[model samples]
Target: MATTEMPNWFVTQFNKRAQHIYQAKGNRLKGTVAGADRIEANEAKWRLVGKGEAKEFQRGQAATPANTGRGIVGAPLKTFQFFDEVHDYDSDRAADPNGAQEKEKIFEQGGMALGRSADREIMNVLNTGAATAGNNFIDLGTTAFDAAAAMTMCQRLQAADVPWEGQVYCPLPSLLWNQLLSAKVVNSSDHVGQDLPFVKSTDTRFWNGVNWFLLSDSFFPVPAANKFDVFLYHKEAVGHAPHTELKTYWTWLNKFTCWEVNMLSKGANVLLQQEGIVRLRAPSNTAITLN
Candidate 1:
């Protein structure tokens, strides 16, 4: 006798499909961060080094190799699990009206929510670490975000020899975004090019060696006496580890009236190289007392 219920392979296929969709659109930092698969059960590890220095060489002989030293970077993995159920009392195949498409949608949306939360946590780590480092903090006390402020941030990174070849992400809060959108240089063709017209200008999105990304207020970490904190960094600044791909399991309910589907994944974030990130703090139209 052959079984007629949903097979194990069917559930596996659904899980793979869900994972594909989740990976494609779930995380904003998917392609931006230094990512790696977690080989160990609950932890990921990597090595980091400081900038190397140059020394005077005598004639053609190779000079003594400089020791930059290395540090081990590691973080514990985490899981973001979700579950939901659909009931179809009168059917043998449970309530899969859309062939489990709705379940996949739930998984994808849940993955996105978790991804956004992780993005915020990673930003907090970077910003706080930058503050402690002392050199990477750019203060804009009670000042609006203007072209000059933008240039100052860029120039500071440049002075530190941070490469400008790749795109720089500026995750700005709505408050700061509005101020930047109203800035003259951002909308003017005079600064960008003759091809850019004010009405159809793409200057705001891509300008001054930086790509602007607007983030929600809750996601943007505002420190004490500050209105907003902007993260301007290269992709190498943060690291990501995913131990388990998005997977799902199903369980039959009493009398096959309903079924439960669970989505699970294990992952975590790390600040790989703090020097590659710059944290800019600024006050909104309202000023707060600075410490």
Candidate 2:
């Protein structure tokens, strides 16, 4: 039997190709153009009717409808203005000859799905402990990464004060043998399941239509009130505008990855300027942290 070792020329060629893919992913997320506001033109401004005779003589009334000025939407900039610009690559060179050769294939394979893996990374930052639960890590925050914690926390979000019911998920989607496992969950985020854009459809054709590629803006955690019926484009969906502050969020996955985003909730809206602060009411007292 003859052994066939891979050539160095092929490895170098593949590495370059893999790197270019990252740029392509960034371009896709940095949508073609920023969208304009979608609010009604009239509701932005209202004219006051003057009292008694002042109202009757509306032509001369200072606060009448005639004097109403052109009003802009309550800050159109808030709609997912995702302006994240990135051009970083792993500067660390491959040391082992085997790693260098094997990684070329692995990188391509992983990068093909890196978009979704990256999406998983973003959520992992929110629930770091759960991300590593399969590895046998004990707990997350005060609660163990068990069914009880996810269920209790999920219900709390559904309550009146912090009314939110977001779908929880396991660390990885494709790796887990969903066929092998009992197709039911007791009470974990994965038990309830998070809904990807086209996840529910049963068409096994094009990934763009149904397959899960690791696009930057493809996966995200949206609150109930924030969830909409329509599936907007990723750029418009996540608000990743060029040269925006939001694009400069913390990188939880790899410290060097620019794909990470702001982890805190701001004001009553997730958009707008990063308020970076959240108020949580616990059994003992309230806890505030800047995301």
Candidate 3:
């Protein structure tokens, strides 16, 4: 029988190497992994953590205005730490996974991540995930994401066996992106990430109209890829939310990796048949106009 061998130095060596790697990538990590609250000052976290109980006086007599107001003191400022796990979709983007995790070394536990693509694509996605607080590593419960399942979601939408003019194929509905964050299906390493919503969820704004797709936009359209254009529901935008709220949502939504499009509507979906919609005949590369 052969004897198995184990080394005691493994853990120590791994920790040392990891620390070195993090120090090397600290600056780049700041941009992607550290949330605004963490990198910037977090007043909310500070006040909550530092709050102390009020002192009660002897009798039920409240005399001075200062007593009525109660002596209030602010808590000591806190240094927010983002030791979050992020799954990267594409490794080529600026904040790649391996690089980002390496930067995490400066944090308390030395952050780590799981990624879905080659080393190059993995690094970038890591960088993006570290970019925010709400963002985290979300799989479809399982690491595997079925594209066929996504397509089936579209094909299965018919009633009484009706074959329609259009269809939508989406990945796991739970993993479908709401904005910048995504539970990307990795290992396949597919770069194409346009998943039109096949069936409407609780979200009320996006629906398939008889002729075209209905879009209930949160705010101003996002910057689309060269292959696609942003569909602005201007009327819906005005009716849905006030201008100030829309502006805030727009800034955040633009950073999202997901782009949701309503499948062909009964009255308004023939925009695909238009002459220039196929390619960029317009001035902007993001030429997704309805007309």
TM-score to true structure, per model:
0.75, 0.25, 0.17
Compute the lDDT for candidate 3: 0.22
Per-model CA lDDT versus the true structure = 0.65, 0.27, 0.22
Best by lDDT: 1
Taking the tens digit of each residue's C-alpha lDDT, what string does model 3 give over 156-252? 3332132343322111111222220122332222332222221231221122311112222221112243221121111110100000100000011
Query: On residues 241-261, what C-alpha lDDT tens digit does candidate 1 reach at each position?
Result: 766756677776665556666
Candidate 2 structure quality by residue, lDDT tens digits, 28-74: 22221123343333221112222232345556556645443333323
Backbone Cα, N, C clashes tallied per candidate: 0, 13, 33
For model 3 the TM-score comes to 0.17
Runs of candidate 2 with Cα error greater than 4 angstroms are 1-144, 160-291
Task: Let me know the TM-score candidate 1 reaches against the reference structure.
Answer: 0.75
Q: Which residue runs of candidate 1 sit more than 4 Å off their true CA positions?
A: 1-17, 59-65, 87-93, 96-105, 187-204, 255-257, 284-291
